[model samples]
Structures are given as C-alpha cells and as structure tokens.
Target: MAKKKKKQKPKQGHPARLQQGVVSMDRVKVGRGLDALTGQFVQWYAEYRDDPELALMVLAAVRETLGVYAEVVGLNKVTDFDPPKLLAVLNSMIEFEETENPEAASNELGTMIYMAWVDYVEFLRDTNQWEREFESLDWFQKTLEAQDPFAGEDEVEADDELDAILDSEEASIAALAEITAMPISTMGRAVLSWVLAGGSSLWTSLPIDQFVETAAKAVENDLPAGLEETRKGLAVALVLQALEAVNAVTLNPQAAPERGVRSQDILEPEDADSFDVNFYFIQACLDMLLEQPGENDQAALEAWGLAALWIVEAADGNPQHAAAPRDEQWSSEVWKTAQVRMHELRVLGLLESGEAYSLPNIVRLAVTDVDDDIFEEDDELDDETLDAIFGPDDVDEPKRLKRETPYTGEVLQLKLTLKDSKPPIWRRVLVPMDLNLGDLHDIIQASFDWYDGHLHSFYENGFGGTTYGPAIAEMDYQKNEAETLVSSVLKKEKDRLDYVYDFGDNWEVRIDVEKILDADGGQLPRCTGGRRMAPMEDSGGIGGWEAKLEILNDPDDPEYEEVAEWCEDFGLDDGEEIDPAYFSKEEINANLDLEF
Candidate 1:
C-alpha cells in the first residue's frame, strides 16, 4: 500500500518576509502545495456532495489549474501565490485556450479555469495564508472586464486554415510544399508516382534488402526532376529506416520498442502472429512518427513512409491477405479491446475514409505545426544549456532477448509463495510455457485477488538480474514485461523467478517451476492449490498487515475498532470476526477463466 505524506502547516512570516525579485534560497519543498490543493478539493467537494460527478469535474479543473500555474510560475507551492502570480496564471490560461481549441476556450472550460483560481484564492484566505492586503478577486474582475476577448482574430483565422488543410489532400500537399520550400508540381508528381507504384505495400511487403535497393533505384531513376540530389538521398534513407522499424515491429508484435507509448505496449505477441498484428503495429508506428517528427528531412520522409503504409493497411480496396487463427489459448481481453479500438478508428475516419486509394491524413499533420504553449521552452537553448537548466533526461536502454525456438505443447506448473508471511499465503497454477511476464503479472494479481492497481515486475535471476515491468517515466528496467516470455527465463523444472507487486508495499512472491506437463487439452491458468487470503492493499507491508491482524483478532485492543473498520472497507469481513486463513480456489479459477 502506498503511504500519503503528512501535510505541514506553513510557519509564520515565511513567504511574507520575502521581497519582490528575490529568489527564496529555501530547499525546494515537495508535496506541500499538493496537500493544500487537496484540502481545497475537499472543501469544493462538500458543496457538490450529492453530485459526485460534478465534484470530480471540479477536481479535474483544480488539477489543470495547478498544472498551468506550475508551468507559468516554475513553482507550485501555494505559499508562492500572490496577486501578481494569480493574474499571470489566469492570463496565460486564457491566451492558451484561445490559441488552441478556441471553441472550447469560449465554453465552460474557460469559466472553470477562472473559477478554480478564485477557489484557490479563497482557500488561501480562509487558511490565513493570503499575505496581500488588497481585494484580489475584485481587482481581478475589473482587470478581466477591461480586456478584449477577441484579441487574436487573425491568429484564430490562421488556425482555422490549418484545420481545413488537415482534411484535404490537395491543401495538405500545398502546405507541405510551402513548409519544405519545394515546388508544388514536383511534390505532387512524386506523391502520384509513389502511389502509382503500389503505394505503401511495395515498401512493406518486400524483404528489407530488396526494399532498400528498390527505394535507392527509384530515387535515381523515377524521382521527379528538379529535386536536389542530397534531398533525394535523405528522403530515401528516412523512408527505408521507417519501413525497417515497422517491419521489426511486425516481426516482434509483442515487444514494446518505444517505451512510455501506451499504444505500442498493450499487445502481447501470443495474441496473434505478425500478419494479424501488422495493421495495429503500423498504426502505432505512425502515431509515434506524428507525435515526434524529428528534424525536417527525417520528419517529411517519416510522414510519407508511415502515411503510405497506413493507407495500404487501412484504406478501402487495399486489404492485407487473410491471416491464420492465432493460438486459442492465448486469447485475452487486451487483444479484444485493441480490435474494438481499431474498428472505432476506421468508423471515425481516423485510419480510413472508405475511399479507394485515399491520400494520407498525416501529410497535413506534418505541415501544420501546433505549438504547445503551456510546455513550450525557449528554442534558442542549446542541449547543454537545457540540460544544465533541467536535469539530464537520460535512461539506460531496456533489455531484450532473441527467441530462437517456438512454443511446444508444454505447460509449467508453478508454485507462487508470498514472502515473509507468518502462516504463508501462496497459489499453485498451470500456465503455458510461452506466457510472457506481462500476462504472468495479471495471473499473479488474479491468484492473490489483488486489484492490479500498482506497478509490478519479474526478476529473471534475482534482484541482481534483469528487471521486467511496464514503462514508467525516468525509471530504468532491463526489459518490458509484455515482451519477455516465461520460457526464456525459466526453461526447466525447479527454475525459479521472483515477482514483486505494489512497489510501495513490496509484496514479493517466489515462483518455482514445480513440474513440466504435456497439454491435457484443459484450460490452463486455473489455480490448482493455494493457502490463506492475500493481504489487503495499502496495508503497509508484511509487518503492517501482521499488526492489523493482531488488532482485528483482539476486540479489547485500543486500535481494534479502527483496524476492523479498515478491513471492512476492503470488503473483507465484519469487525467482530476475521478469517486470515481463508482460501477460495474455485473463485480464483473462475476469475482466471474469465480474464485469460
């Protein structure tokens, strides 16, 4: 269970003594502002107690206001808030809304942002932290009343033009030509010729070596005249590299080559073969390309390469060959959800227009640059300067394995024992030999009746070995849990691995391969044995859990009632009677059957 940090009240004359233009040399206090903001949320929620959804919306607005305030002021501590700071935060928010999604800016979103600041000021005053003597809200009202709401009409008009271009092929081409400083006719002719030469499939279907040679030959013989030789070489190189990346994903559909990207991390390779997974993989790659279009030449080629591939895979009149059925044993809800989302994309005209040989939507996206004003930093800052200003954003490369053998008709019966438990809590289950660590994590959650609310990882050798888990920002790991298979780590009987869940609570489970069995044509992942119920979430660690059990077992204890109430909140049992020895194999198997 994760522990919340205790909030500390502000000392007298802290920020009150600091004069204007003087940076406070105090050590940066973390979580103090967030605690105060949370208190403000409680106060706001009290008014809308009957409407929980409205209360949630208010909470979201408060969070957004806090984020924007942090970006504008470079600090989030509420002690830093003053009249001048409030005005700047509000003005920045309004200008940002007006620039991006102006329609939303004119609606309740703008009003919500304004009211959030008002609530914060009121909270400050109520807490006796409002150091300024002036009438802040009244002054803010008068200031806003004097401003022009339609100040950036010309900028808005330009934004509207970009939006229009995003929906039209000819407009997109013209915009691309303008941005690249290329002749419109030459750009148009090149795109037409590429589409004529089988569009995306020509690049995707051929072997890597053949595609590289083919692209190089096309640049020399078939590219439009008047294009610079250097530009042509760059284009071919970028497209070939992009094609190679997509092909790598097609080959290893389960691997998360790009961490922190949810679309790329969700699918398991066992869910389907390369052919069945190709369409979604290509879409994920295209999303990455658009989200982070590198330097100019690289960006243009990426847009062209990925956009063409997407058109071939998703557009009408160009269907991939039918794929064979994947292993029925590997069917899962995650794959089903991916399929549904894919259908939604097509229905919403995101991936396809239902027109034969449609032009790519991403071409316009590449040309129309939408600046993120809130998070924008100075472009003039060099890499070293930026690194000095902010901390270095470097991470170790994730570990990967080369699987040479395919899954045979084999299953592993494993015993998972919870570490440091008094009477012991454990589960024994059968899983396929080829199950990835990601799926194994899910099974562990099911076996233990955990809510799967926290991050988890599997260790190959031990704590010293490779770490496999989901991609989290700034955290280093050896491999992605979804991509590393069970067989790769535990090959034979008696092989062992350690699984840790809820990093805060640090519940470690020891997994030992008990037996290697042939397929008996029965559903795997069903729990065959176990002992005792798992500990409640957020119950601290093993020590905390033991303390709670002690309290619950004794009615006369001072903390008994409180501990009992907490247990009841988890739907465990009535305060009077608790069963730590409970084990329900049938219920566990039922959930596993549904999940896997």
Candidate 2:
C-alpha cells in the first residue's frame, strides 16, 4: 500500500512564500495565506472538473495568475510558472530559512497546485469553447503521454492511414464491417489497412506505442464489457487482449475457466512443433470462452473441451496429456459449471453442418477426469484433501526416467513489474524457469542493492490456487523433487501480475522475503520477483549497479524522461523546488546534451 508519508509541520515564526513579490512573512500569516490559496484553487478545480472545456479555461486563468505572481516576485519569465514549479519555489524560500518542516512544505506545494488547476478551468469557461475541453477528457487516460509536464493535454500522433479513414467515414465504416466479417487469417491485413485509414491517432494525443498499449488494454478490458463494431479497432483490440489474457492468467489466480476448460498448450519450443496451429486454436478457444460468457459454462467448456481434444486427436491422441473429463468429479464450483456446457457447435449446428466440422474422433474425445483427483492440494487443500489426492489408490505410481535433462534454453521470460509503484518499474530477466528462487535471489542481490526487502511475485497462466498441478507453482523449492505444481497457486498475476514491492524509497529494495518458483519444476534464483536491473551486458560496472545508478540518477537521458516528468508533475522532487526540477537549465543538462 502507498503510504502518504506525512509532512513535518513548521515551527513557530516559520514563513511560507506565495512566489509573488517578497513573500517573507510571519509563520501564522504565511500558513493562513497558503491555506486560502490552496482552498480557492481546489474549489475552482472541483467546480468544473466534469466539464473539460471549463476546466481548461480555469487552468489558463490559473496559469495567468501564477505568471503575474511570478512577475510580482521579480521573475520576468512566466513560462516557468507551472503550479508544481511555483510551489517548489515557495517551498525553497521556506527551506532557505530552515523554518519549514518537510510536511508543511509538501502541503504548501499540494495546496498551491490545487489552486492552479482550479483557476485554470475557470479561465477556460470564461474563454467559451466547451466542446474541445470536453473532448480533452480522453487526454487524461493512463496511456496518453502528454510529454511537457506543463502541457494542458496530450497531443495526438498523425498516422496517414488514420487521416484517410477519418476523411472518408462511409467507406471506412463499410471497410470495418468486412474486417470483422473476414476470417482471422486475413483479418490482420484488413486491420492494418483499416487502422492506417482510421485516424485513430486523432482520438487522443498519446504516443503510438503507448497508444497501442493503451488501446490494447482498453480493448482487452472491454472484451467482456461488450464488443463494438470498429473494424481495425476490434482487430487490434483482440490481439492485445489475447496477449493480456495470456499474461493475466499467467499472473493471477482467477476463478477457474467459466467453462472449466484448461489449455495444455505449452508454448516452449522443444515440445512445440505445430504450436502455431495449436496456438490459433487456443486463441479461438479463449475468444469463444471469454467473450461469450453468457453461454452456459458447461456448454462453452464442451466446445473448448472438443477444441482441446481436436488438437490432441489430430495427432492421434499421442500428446501424452490427460485431464479429468468435464463430467469428472472435480470438487470445484467453477469446474462443475464447466462440465455440462452444451457445445456452441451443437447449438449453431455448425459441428455437423460444415466441412470444417469433420475432424476425426481421436481429435474429439479427451480424458475427462472421472472420480479420481490428480491435482495436489498446494493452495487451498486442507490436510484431509491432501490425503485424498495422494491416497494409495488415487494416483498411479510414478515412473522415474533414467535421465532427467535440465533445461538450459529459455522457456519463460520473467518480467517483474513491482505492482505498487509506476510502470516500467520492472526487470526483464530471462532464464530457464527451472532455476530455484534461491539462485535467482543471489543473482538479484548481486545485481541490485534492495538490501532489506523480501518476497517476490510469481504466477503462470493466471491460474493461482492450491491443489498444485500444471497451472500452479511456488517460489521456494521442495526439499526433494517428487512434487507437481499448479499455475493457479502462484501469486496474483491476473490480467497484470502483482509482485511484492516491499522495497523502500530507493526502489532497489526487494521486501524481506526469499525466492520465487514457476509452474514447471524450473526455479528462479530466490530473488524478489520484480523488474531486473540492466542485464550483465548492460551492467557496465559492479554487476550493473553503476549502470542502474547512472540511469537512476540522470533520469532525463531519453531513458528517464517519462519517470522524470511524472516525478515533477506529481511533485516527486527530492525535497527540492520544482523550478530546478523541470525548467532550470543546469537541472536538465542531460536533456540539452550539455557537458558540465
């Protein structure tokens, strides 16, 4: 949880400035002024927040006010008078005297910014263009990347294709219909062409990459919200949504598939000869399952169950996989619901009506787990449930292989995003999933200086629960090897994985815990599951410490732009004034490529 670390109150006689003229004053007088300024700013912003145009108007007015205030303070350049920047200057005045407590300084900063925004919107309302401001609401979206911290809104990127699409609405609308109606194989091309023509960039000012990520997230989030008919929009949306769904399931422990359908398609290259073909089917299955949740669970599961069997049977059922039948006695409400789905194919008569429906029986029938419980109780299983799965008659004796080859190839990519902080607050570490959490830990400890934090995030296919099986796993290793793990038991990585962010301010800190594990018996060194620092190749010195520190310290290096902006716009300066943080030439020397 984010603790709003408190501010230290000022002592008697401490003075706070208003960044206008000589702000030197007595403590009580300064506090009263700061409080009034903050209250007014907040009030202005609060009144017109719902109306974007009005909000912008008010914002402009506030900026003018600040600019005038700066002029009063003997500052000629008003361009540098951003709300955050203004507050920082005020804080600095108090700090120079050493009379303001950290907390008091912070509150002053917050209150001033609050006023600036309020004033800005009121200015907009006075200007009279409400529609544009209303549309600006789109700019506030999480993915929109309005670079200039002082810029009132995000700028849209112009893609030529989008221009054409927006220019010809009727034609574009017709094209969209075909895009959706067309088969998936040919859909990408249509989507490409349509998006090129759709002027989607005009929709918001976010950068293309973030726009895509944001669009993808939007589409994925809305997949279940209800599909709209935008040709290219839906196409890109599904693609990103699929990736997200895959990632989500890999991270979080969601309720079992609504239809109780389990996908055993391992994406590893060694076992994946026709992965593309099976992958296509998996995508289809997910779409059918996730988007059409209105259909009965059993009905959907049966259809997906058939699809799973179809893949297996296409190769004569030799995949060496087994799952409790949908009709099996698995003791999960989620699974039970999936068991009796009346297949969509059956309802639509598509199964028997078309040439595509004639796949062989081997591809149709899957082993429905009957009365036996093959999954272990790793997550929710009590002692009694554990005994049941491992009972003498429940599972057949295991066959030990004479040779167990360790995986040296990359099977899964571990990208840790410390959930608590902001984005790209991550590490992309590649390793054989088989490495233990302890080993991963040593590697992490060597790479970063998160000295006292513990715990890490772990998940596989979004399935987290006890009753370890193929979908769940853990971080610590089993004293000995005879165990099975499930993706469901891993920590919540659903939709987006969540990892332990126990580390303190430096962000390099991993919480005070040890290790992480994956679904396959593969292990990661017992390091906290968060974003990795620069890899060894990029780790110029001290096992990447110097490299991370360089990137960490000089954030404006094309690398730190986003984070740096977020810090300032949000007043995350290292207890300094915002002016030096955003506008001072020396502070942004890195941005100017200036030496010294």
Candidate 3:
C-alpha cells in the first residue's frame, strides 16, 4: 500500500477522503503501573515551574519518541499528530523525572531520561541486546550536549533502573506479546503504556528470546538450533516464528539440510503457486463487502444466498481438473453434504434463516415472475414501493436534449474483454457520442459490477501509452479524464482504446468499437452484451480468476471445499448454475439508470 504524501496547501474542492484511517495511539490502554505514569508526569511538570526551556526540551523528547514509535508501526501520518496524547505523555515523563531526581530536576536532565527510556525500549523491540549496536545509551553524551542550557543532574540512577527492566526476561516477553497483538485502534495508548512502564523500571527485558523459545516448543518441526548462537540465525528465527504464528507459510522439520537449516526448513505449501490468487480473491471479496453500508442487510443476505447456491452447483457439476492437493471430485455426495452444512449453519445461527429470502418480492425475483415490460407500472408493487420507484429526490437526473424523438447520438458499440482470460470473459457496452471518458469508465464498471475502489486510467494507444485519468497535484498528466470525450478519442466504428482499473490488480479491458449507430437514439450508454460473471474483484486479475475457476470445476482438489466455502461466504457462487455467457439487457439498463 502506497502512503500518499499530505498536500502542503488545501485543494479547491472538498478534501479527498482517506482510503484508510490513521490509527490513533491514544486508544491503546497499557497494562499495570503504566496507567499511573501520566499522573506522575503531570505532578513533576508542576515541580519544574520556572524551567520553560527544560519543559520544551522534555516535551520535544516525548513527541519525538511517539513519532518514532508511529513510524515503526507504519503509521507515518500519526507520528506528529494527536496533541492530546502527546500532552499526556509529556506530563507523565515530567512526573516520572520528579520522582527520579527531585533535588536537581532540569529540562536537560528530564529530556535525557525520557530519550534514554524510549531509545532503549525501541532497540529491544527492533534488535537484540547481544548485537553490538544494541547499546541504546550510545547517544547519552550527544543528546545532552546538543541541548546544553544548564549543568544537568546525573542520569545514572535512571539508566540503572532501565537496565534492571531490560534484564527481566518474563516482563519483557509479556510486554512484547501485548505490543505485537495491539489492535490498530488502541496502538497509541498501548505504546504510551509501554513507555510509562519502561520509565518506571517495571519492564526489564525484550521478548525475542522468549518468542523463539515458545515457537520451538509449540512447533513439532525441528527448528534450527545452530542459529541460536548467531545474530543472523536469531534474526531469521524471529521472522520465521512470526510467519508460523499467522500460518501464511510453514516450515518442514524433516527436510534434508544441504547448506543449513535455513535453506531446508522453510517449506512452501501445495498451493504456493497460486498464493497471490487465493490471497487477492479473499481480500477483494472482503473489501467489496465492507464498502457497503451496514443498512444494506437485505442485499447482503441475498448475495450470501446466491454465493451458497453457486458453490452447491459447482460441486455437483463434477468438472474435470480442480485446484491441486486433493483429488475427490465434485459429485452428488458433495452437494448433499453442502446442503446439510448449510442447514446446520442456519440452525446454529451461523447463517441467516430461510426467512431472509422468503419475502414475496424476493420470491418473485427468484422465479423471475415480474412483468415482461420492466418500465411498465407493476400492479404487485405496494404504494410505498411505487413511491420509492418514482422517488424524484433520490437521484440527480441527467439532462437530455428535448427532441421529438429520443435524444440521439452517434453510438459506438464496444467490446471490453479481460486480457488473457481463458474462454474469454468480456462485456459489450454502447457509448453515446456525448459521454465523457470519465462517465465511460463508470459505465464499464457498472457492466462488470466493479466496486470502483481503486484508481483507473484510459490509454490512447493501449497499455503503455499516453494515459489520462484523475489528476494528482504532484504530477503532470497528458490528458484529463473528466474533460476528455469518448468520441474525441475514438470517433469511427472499429476504433479502439484501452481502459485499466485497479492498477495493482492490472485489470485491462480492451475497448473495440464494433458498430456505430447512424440514427438510433435509445438509452445512450448501456450494456449491449457480456460473457461470464466479471471475475471477482481483486482475483489477482485474469490469472487468479482462472485459478479460482479451476478449483471450482474440480471437486476432488484439496482446495475445492475451501474455495467453495469462500464463494459461499461472499454469496458469489450460489447453488444455482450461473451461465458464463449470460447477459440481460433489461438488467444492464436498470444498472445504467443508477449510474447515469
């Protein structure tokens, strides 16, 4: 994830919404005596009443430490922000200094104590004490001289207490685990607590040795013992332990060692080849689900139901060649078990009851029992539903020319295909002459049900050519999307352009204008045709989607059940067979209404 640099000056329009929130460290609540550290600092600051320079220096040290901690956790923006917590930390550190040196409390003295505590703790967290560079007090003389104002009191007592805390094996391990598991929301508070505890000499050791020991005990695999004697070995062990905890990857205890244990012990899983596919597919589905408001419960339930049905249907199809590691193919038996599992989930309150899908309107939708002319008034729709249907205040109606006939435009019928897709997945969209490239992007997204969560760009000469999209303040662009008309780039039939969205996923759609309408006026921009469901969002582009298809086709693959379960979770693959070539012009038009 790229962290965008903050702009120096405010932009003209509304501020851009942050893709993610900055984790507030103030939310973390540290354990034990750490809680009282703030109160102590407040009291100490009051004691040093005349020492303004001392106060500034002390405050700066606290702020600097918090900033360093934030950067360590990848929260760069949060470093210099959150004044309330900084103030609290400043109070605590002063209070801590007062208790340590009541007779000779100076700004220079307090800053040294605070800096020493912070650097030492961070050092332990980042590296081991056995490493030569782990001497945290290496900066003791420099920091004091840099901020020289008065002859400072000795910090030997404070250093001694810090050393005592670092020497305690159990205390440090517990603190590290808590730090590592700190939730994003509570990180700030938790970090403050650690600093407070360390200042009080409550925490005395680092968790590296303890974590390594724990991993050795829990994992059945023969962990390399040779690395225990070397700094490099311990570093590798530290990383491996973290990986093993998450199960992102695993290690083999019995693999024959050629060069060393590091070479032979780390083992790749059977699905390692498609790790990106599985990771991206699951993450995309989750991201898609999260983007919707919680009030959309009914729609969410329908999606879940549909996904369940898709899985059941795929399992029953018994297609050849599923994902690897398992060979039990999809069969009637698998379908039966899936049904049982679904029922059990409902009974256990894990899945919603059948009532979720039992509404009359939903039933009608399931059976496609609505009127043939979708635009015609529906006799079955209730007064409230009818009112909702014709709700004028709900949408911003697009302006159209007042013509005796429909507003006519030169229509370009374009085919958009997923690059490198097997069996070729694509969408056909009709673009109006007046529609700008920006709106065209939206129409394409609507055709494929993409959530539009990532950045997109249109290229004049396909993939690597001149691009135009949203403009960033820091960069110059060849073209601006909102002002660039679709017709301006491709006026004639058979002309083409390339559209890519979600740069990370690199989903490239080839837009080829197959036919141009001479006099036709109908709904200007609409889906004319499409093949297959657009690959799940973030399914690692075409390759990941294909891998997922392979898993769905084969029931016997070890990952088949897992893949099927995943589809059900997102309600993507319901038991009902979804035709890969299915296209509904009415449905497409309905979506266009929402978009336009």
Candidate 4:
C-alpha cells in the first residue's frame, strides 16, 4: 500500500510588517529634528508649561515620530497590514487636537502629542528651535522629514513606576498625561487607565501633578465607560491571544521583534474586548483595504465587515480611525467595511446597480457556484482576450493571400492513428488549387479525426514551410486560410537553416502532398476570400447532414455504389507508393524536374 502524505497546514501568526530595534542613547542616529519653528504663533505650552512640557515632549516626540515614520514608510512592518482592535482607539482621540481632517488623518496620535509637546517645551526653554526647523522646510523638505526614522526609547525601561519619582504636582499631572500616551499600564490594564480605573501602576504614588491635566482630559473624553471600557481592553487582549488559536498570526521576532505585534494576536479567538485593546488590529484590515483592495475573500470579507460594524457600533460612531469631524469616509473602519460588503453583495449578485465600486471590491470578489477549490481555473478563454490576441481584423480577416499556380492544382494528405485502438482505422482527404497557407488547415480537418472545441493552426510543410505553413490550432482552422493549401514550401538558397515546430497531435502523425495536372487544364486562379459553400449533404451537422444521413439508404443499396467508389479513389494517402500503370507517362515526366 502506498503511504499517504499529510497535507501541510498553514502555520499561524502575523507576519511583522513594522520594523523596530534598540539604539543606545548616545549613538542613536539623530536627535530633536524639529528644533526650529516658523513664526506666526503661540509658545504657551513650552514657556509657561516648562517641566511638564519637557516630560510630555519626550513621549510626544516618540509617539509623533513613530507615527510620521508609519505614514511615510508605511505600516508594512508591524502586522503585514492585518486588522486589529484598540480599546484605546477611543482614548487616542484625546492626543489629537483635531481628528476630523483627511490630510490630518495621516497624523499619528503619538506624533501629534509629541509635536505639541515639542512646541510647548521649545518655547519654555526660550528655544524656538523645532518651530524654526519646521518653518524652513520646502515642500521637498517636508516630504523628506516625513520619512525620518522612529526615535530610540533610551534602551532602558524605567523598570519601576516612572510617575512616582516626579517632583511637583504640575509635573506629576504631566506624567499622568505621558503615562496614557504609552501603554504604561502593564501586561494588560492601560497604565493610564490603571491609574484612572483604580488598579495601581506607578501613577497612583506620583505627586498630585501627574493626574491634573490628562485625567481631566480622560474624564472629559470619557473613553468608553467604567469596567466596560477596561473590559473592552481585556477583550482586545483576548483577540491577541487567539492568534495562537487559529494559528495564522504570530509575533515575527525574526522580522520585527517586540514591535512585531501582529494581526492574529491582536484579535485572537479566545480574547475579549477585540478593538479596545489595540485599534491597529482592525486598522490592519483597513490597511489591507487601503493597500490592496482586490485581495478580499469570503472569510476575510465577512470578518472585516463584522468587525467594522462592531467597532463603529461600539464606539458609537466615535471611531479612533476617525479624526476630528468624524464625517470622513476613508478614515472610518465601519465605513470601509460597509463599502466592502456592499461590493461583495453586488458581485455575489446580491446588490443592484447604481452605487460606485467600494474597497471590498478591491478585497474580495463574489462567487456563485464554487467548487471546493475556489482557485481552480478552466481551459476556456474569455471573448475579450480572444478578440485581443487575434484582433478584429485577424479573427475577422477581410483579405486572403493570393498565389499564382500552374494549370494542375496542388493536393495535401493527412493520416491519423489512435493510441489505444487496434489497427487504428482512419480516413484520408485530398484538396485542390489556388489555396494559400490558411486554406490547408481546413482541408486537413475535413480529412481526419478532429475535435469540435479545440483551436488549430496549420503549417504547409513542417515548421518553416511556406506554401502549406503551420495550421493555426489543432481542432479548428480558419476557412479563409484553409482555402489555399500549398503543394510545396518556399525554401531560401542562402540555406541558412534553423529548427522549427513539426505539426499535428504528436510525433507519429504525418501528412503528404501531391501536385499533378493535365497539360490541357486551364491556368490556376488566385484565391479570393470568396469560396463556394460546403454541400449540405457532405457531413453530419445540426440541421441538414445528420438528419439527411439518418434518412438515407445504406451503401449496399447499389444506388450508392458511385459515391463510395468516388470517395475511395479521390482520397489522399499516407505517403503510399502508386503504380506507374495507374498514371499516364506525362505525370512521371513532370516529376523529373522536382527537387526536395
């Protein structure tokens, strides 16, 4: 017995799309990029805010720079652009001064906070550095700055509550703001929320300053509500855990390390909250829609749609993917999902016309009756492609090749042998005159075993044969081209010979040609596309041939004797030798001048 091989199952995990690495504080690539500012504005956050602003800028810059890097560089590094949920998706709004803009949608919540802090700190230090830098950028400079790399995290974690060691109350409050900026919470509880939700991280022990400002924003922003909100965070974490369940999303340490957090883990099967844990989970799906719209499948489409509806409904329309105004269609996952499902329904033949194409059309196509393997393709070509390859003038050719010939017309023969049949009985045919390269193709079809559906092209000789040329396809040939069958090939004396394809179904198949005419026969005429119609009685067909044959008498009827003898005598043979006695001496004399 043959041993059965096991099919390899797809492994689980997210392919890291984002890239991150540790850098020493001293040797890191560059620092404080936006030190100079163009005039025109306020320095309230920096001059008046001072210490709190410094702490804020540290994180603000980290977040902002990471975000800018994401846009210019793209999200390909972290999650292979897969989807996930962020419980903080709601909280992320607080970081942005304005969330409703399209061009603004590209702004990183972290970057916005960082730049805002930078603006504030610079002013406080009596330094207009970053603003000046930002001001001097030409459009080209802005584009280049947008691609700058992520800032280093000092290669060290506080390892302890960073907020507790702060000095004044204002500074403490600033730490609280910064705390929320990072996920400082712990293995789970958003540290900012840990402080807000009553679970202690380092924030609880911090001076009164920490909670003052951001806590006010936290309460004012009112991200979700109660444990329902924290529960939402837990829910998202569960999604991440489920990455191990379905086994498609895993951390890509090799490609991207800790920052490699991916889609599968973002929305793991067993996880709770779903999006509140991390918005990128869903954003990843949306990212896919953004990057590649035509890749959506049934499973992926459904998952994305449901997740979009959930996030939108759960957020009550206040989506993190949304910026300030909340009306933008491209920025909302719910809006994006709805667009895709509509496409799926439309293509599935579920929806009617009138609407424009959506991102889902880009993600997945609709299917009616699919076999188990959705990817298998059939061997039929679409009409558009057929028209394209052959072109209107070719498939619908209006011209024919004209050839001059001697009085006696040319003839070609074809023979076929089957692989399994014993003795493989077959049929033969001979055709006449003025026929060009394309004409021989049809004559061969009429004389031998051919299929109804396959396309065919014919050659006069083998590969390079001129007169007979290659048959267009195997099953069917052009009638116009088939009209002028060649008796011989046009070979050049330069005799620079090259290899060519020999025709027919396979190696053993062969053909022969003969040219002979009585000296008294009139000169051959040039073939026009014009040709006499095929006799209705000549073959079995839809209306006449098959019906006519069914009602015709048998060959033994004696009346049919003439027809049978004509068929046998006129047919071409497979290179068979003919007795001289069967032909006049004139034929043998004419052949004496011929050369291969």
Each candidate's lDDT (Cα)? 0.51, 0.31, 0.44, 0.29
Model 2, residue 385: C-alpha shift (Å): 29
Please report the TM-score between candidate 3 and the true structure: 0.36
Ranking by lDDT: 1, 3, 2, 4
TM-score of each: 0.36, 0.18, 0.36, 0.19
Model 3: per-residue lDDT, tens digit, 347-390?
Answer: 21223334231212111221121122212323343322322222
Clash count, candidate 3: 29
Best by lDDT: 1
Q: Which candidate do you rate higher for TM-score, 1 or 4?
A: 1
Clashing pairs in 1: 1-538, 399-478
Q: Compute the lDDT for candidate 2.
A: 0.31
- Tell me the alpha-carbon RMSD of every candidate: 23.0, 29.2, 27.7, 28.8
In model 4, where do residues sit more than 4 Å from their true spots? Answer: 1-426, 430-435, 442-510, 513-596
Which 10 consecutive positions of candidate 1 have the poorest summed lDDT?
Answer: 3-12
Model 2 error, position 296 (Å): 16
Clashes of 2: 103
- Model 1, which residues run further than 4 Å from truth? 1-408, 573-576
